[model samples]
Target: MADSFLRPAVSTMRSGIAGALIAVLALAAAPTIASAQTAAPATKPAAKPAPATKPAPAEPAKDAAAPEDPLPWIKICSKDADKKNVCLVAKELRSQEGQLVASVALRDIEGDSKKVLLIAVPPVVLIQPGMRVQIDKGKQLEAKYTICFPNACYAEMEIADQAIAEMKKGKALVVTSLNIQQKPMAFPFLLSTFKKAAEGEGIDPNAGQQNQEQLQQELQKRAEEAAKKLQGGDAAKPADAPATPAPAPAPAEAPKP
Candidate 1:
């Protein structure tokens, strides 16, 4: 009976010791698990995409057309008799009958900083009164008569930079002078192409010569036509028409007696 009782006590004590050891191991592992969970990194949120942009519109196509003709005004460059370089931007106005009415030119000579404005009009103008130049209702500038030839009378003045600037912006250039009868005569030259011609290149010397020849021919033709008209008018009168006789030495006989 004693052996059975002791064996039962030992068995119960051994079972209690094993259960305590297992509980202590679980308590130690619980702290390790908690530390590991706290040390782990957190996840980041994803970024949103940017909005799209619209494309720019294309430009319109340009139309193709033939080039326009050059303006009538011209620039001529040549050497003077002194071997110095000279240039002129010139334009001529003509009547319906192809007669030259007037000419306007800007002359530039080498070694000279200032430009000269030259005007040529028919010789029927008064020299003492001088001439006046106006641009688009602007101030009137006076030019003195420099010289005269059989065909044309020339007037010139040293043009300032300000006047040239005005000419470029003006619509018309009006040149006024006193006629033989002491009346004002105005000649207008269109300024629409003045700027272009003033800045453009000059023609060849040979071409300029040809132009001069053509102008001479035209003038000669006009003169011939005028002479023919006068001759025709004279011829229309009777060739046998008696000339007006002088008061036939009327008093000669009476004085002698």
Candidate 2:
């Protein structure tokens, strides 16, 4: 038996023991790390549920109004503009294109003017002279006015077939503006220019004149009839009907005794 072989064998056995210890420690540490990672997610609470939403209620309906009544078409019945008062405001009888209309009395016109300018306000319309306005018909337009620069005396107007026919030639439209000549001599000249322009547009001159005359005659006839009735000529009631009763006056209070 040799001592040398025994020493070598002892050293080899010590090395093997040390390697086994290291492997055991590694297996134990691995289990602890895996357990910690797995348990972390389980401890966390579940996310809170979202809140529920509700829809809004529907709105109620609203009320609407009816359509409006159109303005009455009319022209001057009298061309008596020379004395203190020339035009008499009256209700419109009818329109040139077609239709019957009503009107309201505003004030008596002053001066001696032929043509009257009628301002249409919904149901009521007025005709007055010395007034300037713009008219359009399907494709026609007529603008009557005056110009005074330094010494210009003559006033002129125009009626074109293609530009503003929608206003002057059309069956219906609006009167946007109203201007009176204010000067008597200028108005008749203005009227002549307007008449010529209308003739050029194929508008029935006789018809327009007839309308004016008809209105005049109607108004005059009405006046005469009114006068006759007032004078006991033709009346529904006796001319000797009792007069209207007067209103009673307020009584004064007596002083306390």
Candidate 3:
């Protein structure tokens, strides 16, 4: 009976031990299985694009690049101009045919209104490099100008002084037909800075304005002198003044009555 009991107890102990060993083996393999599953790398997401940069600002416009004014017109048909129907712009500096310094256009006012002269220069004129500026054509200039527009005159070449003298001996003025630089319109662009050059040549368009102040002073002086004379006033003479000589007899003396 004792041996039977002992044998059954030992067998029960062995079964418990076997069950514990199986549990230990399963725990040891659990980590390996987990590692195998983790070894497969994860799918990466697509990278986002970088932000765009801002653009720079634009540049400013130029001012001094403007063209020149036209040649001042010769005044015609004005009482101030001796009532002549034809006006003339005389050349102070003679221009040679190929000397090519500057070119100019003419703008004349038409009718009663005081505004920029409306006119055009034909492209036939070979004007020198210049600017085109607007000027008011008063009635003093003439009935109107011959060439007038935004840029009626185009490309003018300048000639040398010596060449100009040579041409003048032959009595010729290098006149060019009108042309356009970059457009279809017949506007006068300055082949040369004729107006600015004219200033250096001693033409003063502001003479009228200057005359007002000068004339006033002159008139006042004349009036004072006249008033003194009319009132029988005599300028104080110096005590050291020389004696006045008697008037000489006429070259051909007439017989007195």
Candidate 4:
């Protein structure tokens, strides 16, 4: 009786243990199914793009108004050399009637250091009497025409130290030139600040400005002085002035007549 009871009880216990093990396995499989149904699907990684390029900067806007030019009266320039400040002084001359007549440039000549005046006249003007520059009714500096270009006639003159001194110290300069008619036209170059212009390598255009009436007066005064000097030299014979030598008496004609 004891064996029969024990065998049935043990069989029932084994059945119960097998069902528990099956239940645990099913519970583990249920979680896997739930995860597969609810979880996000995997996909290939997106390709990285090439490095982006930078955009070019925008350009500045152009000005609307036309650009202004530098002063038209004069220009100063320097050349490259061992000496740092070797420069040229330049000026443009215009007529009272608003015509461009001439240009003048000055420089201290190398080696000798003499001042040189390079005068450029209009091509249409006469080259005779060459070109003359004087300071405040002072003695004239004359130079013969050396070249003629399509645009201008050029005369270069070495200025004496005395003349340069006078120019630097004087009030004005008178530039005389012959026109196409061979008439003398005097241009009074105002030298109000010439010293500053030469040393500083530039002229104050306003410093040299003169009115027409003032120019006319200066021209008249210069003309009168020039005329007086001419007349005085020709007519005013000093008492001790040597007389003109008389021509030799005609040779005595042979008595054949």
Candidate 5:
């Protein structure tokens, strides 16, 4: 009976120690398991994209209109103090300095079949050689120097109907003269509007006087533009003064013999 009681007590003590060990192990592992379950998940990185290219610029558009003519042919009609009708189809060219380069006119008198081609040139030319005029490559005509004024020397020739017809159909009227240096100088006058101007009615006697201011303004504008172009469009510098016109001859004054 004593041996049986001792064996039962020893077995009861071993069972209690094993249960305590199992409880301690479960308590230690509880925190690690809870942390793992509540923690956030890691994220993957995004891929990079390529850059875009830019487009090129466009070009400017061109102008379509034609340029205007600087000098144009004109016809003038007036009565002299003597009460005689005088009509002239004329063109004049001048230098930037306001000096006259050359002037050509076809003078017509009422009740007269004879028409005169009057030309005025600078006094620096040789009067002995006279003047030569040609329409394009056609026949050349000779004109004699009739008189010399302070500003210009005059030359005149009688023009026939045939010459007028030829001039109407010509492209240019070329006037050749010998300079003081004995070198030949040529002046080409455009005949593009010659036919129309010759056939058209003459403007009033006061028309030129009325348009003088406008003409001066146009000349001034052109001079300014030319200067700007030469200076590479620099507008700070002022342009030179426009040239003054020389006094025109009276309509009644014909070339002397």
Candidate 6:
């Protein structure tokens, strides 16, 4: 009887253990089945935006420069005999007939920090009108007539920093003055001369001494030639022509009668 009871209890315990194992297995398989049934959340790719393009830059403004002179022009720097800079620029203008009409010169004198501009126009221009200068049709500058010589009328003005800057940037300079008929006449000035003048040039220290020496030598030579001519003329004056027939020596013979 006891064996039968023990066998029944053992069978019941095995049944209970098998049911608990099945429940545990179902619980573990539930998550795997649910995961299999549901698909991974579809992740839509983000839409890409177009690149922002930059606008093109605007063109720069052009410089409003004037036309160049058609006539012959020169860019010259004046130097002493010793090859030292005496002046920055000396621009000479000639007429179509090859006659000099005007000259413009720039010089930086020693001990003076200011630069001087000297313009020489024909004597026909009126002294009162002086010179009306315009740089590239910009500002109008009036310079007074300082003096006049036989060949030209001179207008002098000190070149300040502002004038130099304007000249360098300018293409052409127009100078106007009154003619003999009191009519306005225009002269085109090449800016290249101003550029050459503005360049920092070295001045000659011995230029004054050299000029004085040259002048003295020239004067001495002229004096010697004059003296020689005078002496020669005095010597030849009696011989070139017969002397007044010796005041008629026959008159002396007649005194005796």
* Clash statistics: count for each candidate: 0, 30, 43, 0, 0, 0
Look at candidate 6 and give me any clashing residue pairs. none
Model 1, position 32, has a per-residue lDDT of 20
Error at 107, model 5, angstroms? 0.4
lDDT of 3 at 91: 21
lDDT tens string, model 1, 1-257? 00010011211112232233233223212112222223345346458645536545544444333222122456778888999888888766543233345668888888999999988776668999899999878999999998876656779899998888888876678888887889887767667677887777877556754665466477567668988999999889776999888776545455655
Q: Summarize candidate 6's per-residue lDDT along 160-194 as a digit string, tens digits.
A: 76876888776666667887788876656667546
TM-score of each: 0.54, 0.22, 0.19, 0.45, 0.60, 0.46
Assess candidate 5 and give its lDDT: 0.63
Stretches off by above 4 angstroms in model 1 are 1-71, 209-257
Model 1, backbone clash pairs (residues 3+ apart or across chains), number = 0
Q: Which candidate has the top score in lDDT?
A: 1
Ranking by lDDT: 1, 5, 6, 4, 2, 3
The global C-alpha lDDT for each of the candidates, from Candidate 1 onward, is 0.64, 0.29, 0.29, 0.52, 0.63, 0.53
Residue 105's lDDT in candidate 2: 19
lDDT of 3: 0.29
| lDDT-superior candidate, 2 or 6 | 6
Which candidate leads in TM-score? 5
Task: Give the residue spans of candidate 3 off by over 4 A.
Answer: 1-46, 57-79, 82-188, 191-257
Residue 120 displacement (Å), model 6 = 0.6
Q: What is the lDDT of residue 71 in candidate 4?
A: 15
Cα TM-score of candidate 1 = 0.54
